[model samples]
Target: MRLNDCLTPAATAIRRKAASSRELRSNLRASWGDGVAFGGMVGFGETYLAAFVLAAGLGELTAGLVGSVPLIAGGVMQMVSPLLIRRLHSHKRWVVLCALVQAAVFAPLGYAAWQGSISAPAVLILATLYWASGLATGPAWNTWIGTLVPPGVRPRFFALRTRASQAAVFLAFLAGGITLQLAGGGPHLMTAYAALFAIAGGCRLVSAWYLYRHTEPSPMPASMRNISWRELLGQLRSGNGGRLLLYLVAVQAAVQVSGPYFTPFMFRKLELNYGEYVALIGVAYLAKVIALPWWGSMAHKVGAQRLLWIGGAGIAPVAAAWMVSGNLAWLLTVQVLSGVAWAAYELAFFLLFFEAIAPEERTSMLTLYNLINTAAWVAGALGGGAILFLTDASHAGYLIVFAASSFFRALALLLLARLPAIEAEGEEIGLRTLSVRPNAASLDAPVLPSLPSQAE
Candidate 1:
């Protein structure tokens, strides 16, 4: 009869539900669904933004810059995330908002396609928004999902989730390529792009829905901590981690030098149609997917440091390999090799870098790394663009940039050599970070801490 008795029942009813077996199972399904839908959005829509730029007559220069330059803005924009997350103290809410914003970015692109053209500036703006929204979600989603997925099963669960997501990415990307090919590769392809963007936007919305369905702990995990630049720099200066980070960033820079321009080269100089272009990209992506498990196993045996040497050596020549001959068969072979090289490089990066971070510091650390990494990316891209601009965007110009990329990649190996040996953990899987790249798929640097090592 007491008021305390009446209030106690209401309080208990409002309490957070225990993560019972059924709830955990449900969360797992929702998380996997989110991966598939997110991958669909990436493949169908995000992957083709540069292609869409070219089709819209935005100029090869613009198309070439599309992939790397905007990432600078996106990187800057994502820096706001850790701050906002600290203020709001809710990773889920921040992540979902970013996802929705990412979905909305497609609308303007689709509208431009409907209008039959878009300016170079407009393409840049839209691309910035897309990257901004997408990048912002990375740090938050990484933290949020760690709490949802139990560490005991984290390795197996994420491995399966990654495979499923990668499959979705490949299938959707292939479908988009086919659709664009069928829609007519020349002037009339705007409608096809528009439709792809629409579907891609819808996929992102569905991804957001599934993200919302995942259970957030009643009070969010207290692992979000601000890592000061001074402290981070001190940490970098004090260990082999700095050399490793330097090497990775340099590799990215070198890769971007040739990376963004490859698509425009395909569309213009090579005169490859949508189908052939898609085939090349798809081959690279499939090869990467297939090679990753092998790379993971190699890491366990030979250690990540050895894996880095293997990957770095292979990757150094990849961009330059394009100059060997532009024959489709040769190109496909190059793609397969490139994919394998990249898979090893990326896995080694995760094992060496992400494994070293404290969970509480991950969000901030990743934010800082994103900025440094993307700066290298933009610088490399701008360097490539300058060469193309100076050479008048000729076929020979593409080769020059490719050679330059290889040169820088080779230089990055010097840094790699200075890297101290890292003992590989015997974990079943490394941390997975989703990144969308043109003409290929591979893991990027981890934007989250390793799950198996999270503080209880």
Candidate 2:
């Protein structure tokens, strides 16, 4: 029978009766395999490239800018994506096009860096292109992901995928670190960095190809009215969404303000060697891989709101731990805890945000979220740079600033307590209530109608 014909009731029933118990496992393996390939390439490539670039005499501010520029550019692009989606009329095509652009941009960046004499203006422009390319892919990719991964089992599936990705990331970091060591910390390092970027770009191309292979079910019909910035603002101002928006803004501001400087601080203040630094970071990523499943389960059980608090409460101590990290051991301990806490925060936040928004509004909602979060990151990065400049990069001063930022994050958690619980599949759920299945149609499922041109 044809593939479509095989999906009929009689065929399904027959398959169910004949199917071995291993079928489910086999399907899961396929999903996770794809996830791993995609995650490994993107995650490792991004981190390895950043570390390599920083080692090539990019000042701390410049290094931080490299990291933040993509976010800043991506955020700005996201603001207009909803409209673009309407005008373009094809999320998949747009995503593929963006991926191609990303590949094109990076090849030149690598070549320029390898040749040396890359001007600051050129670097900034390339960075902007790179960032924009990545950012443009977001809405389409995210929407496509929602279609591919069903809602009811998202937490479990994501947990499995994250573990696979994290494992790859761990190995990638190790290899990248070794490569940097072999290349040494000078012009040759730039060569290695450029090579890594080339490899990364290749991997991204493969990922894009894989994405194109997958089927995206039809989207919900577009709403009659097009979406506008005014409408978006109104949505934020009028409902429970408004309060959540405020809380998100607060959290983003707090985290981003101090987060970007952590690496530079370690390098400058602690004087960690390249291998040692990457290894330390590897420990954190490893911890995250180990802890993600548990956090995913926890988010499924307890509501994301409560998990948010746990994550927030945990951050203060982790930040505090940094102050006393005079050695690798202390830093490793802090890294483990920070990784676990961040996993919880990330999984919970995404789940919560997905649950809170209606299907029709997902793209716009994500766009807004990205925009706000990006702005916060930019503000924080700029602020951190200013602080460092003013203090002449004093370790003590940076530590104090980071500690304060952690406290501010905790305050945002306190604000989360007052936010309403999100209802999933007609049930009011808490962080501890993991058994409740979310709405399949709502969770990343592609059945929902798209917003009209005006709505977009």
Best by lDDT: 1
Local accuracy of candidate 2 as per-residue lDDT tens digits, 127-239: 67766777666666656655555455554455445556546555755776777778776668778777767776776677567656655454423432245768877877776
Candidates' C-alpha lDDT: 0.80, 0.60
Q: List the candidates' TM-scores in order.
A: 0.93, 0.79
- Per-residue lDDT tens digits for candidate 1, residues 108-199, read 98999988988888889888888888877777787788777777777777878888888888899999999999999566688899999999
Which residues of candidate 2, in runs, are more than 4 Å off?
A: 1-34, 145-159, 216-226, 420-456
Each candidate's root-mean-square deviation in Å? Answer: 3.3, 7.4
Clash pairs, model 1 backbone: none
TM-score of 1: 0.93
Model 1 error, position 317 (Å): 0.7
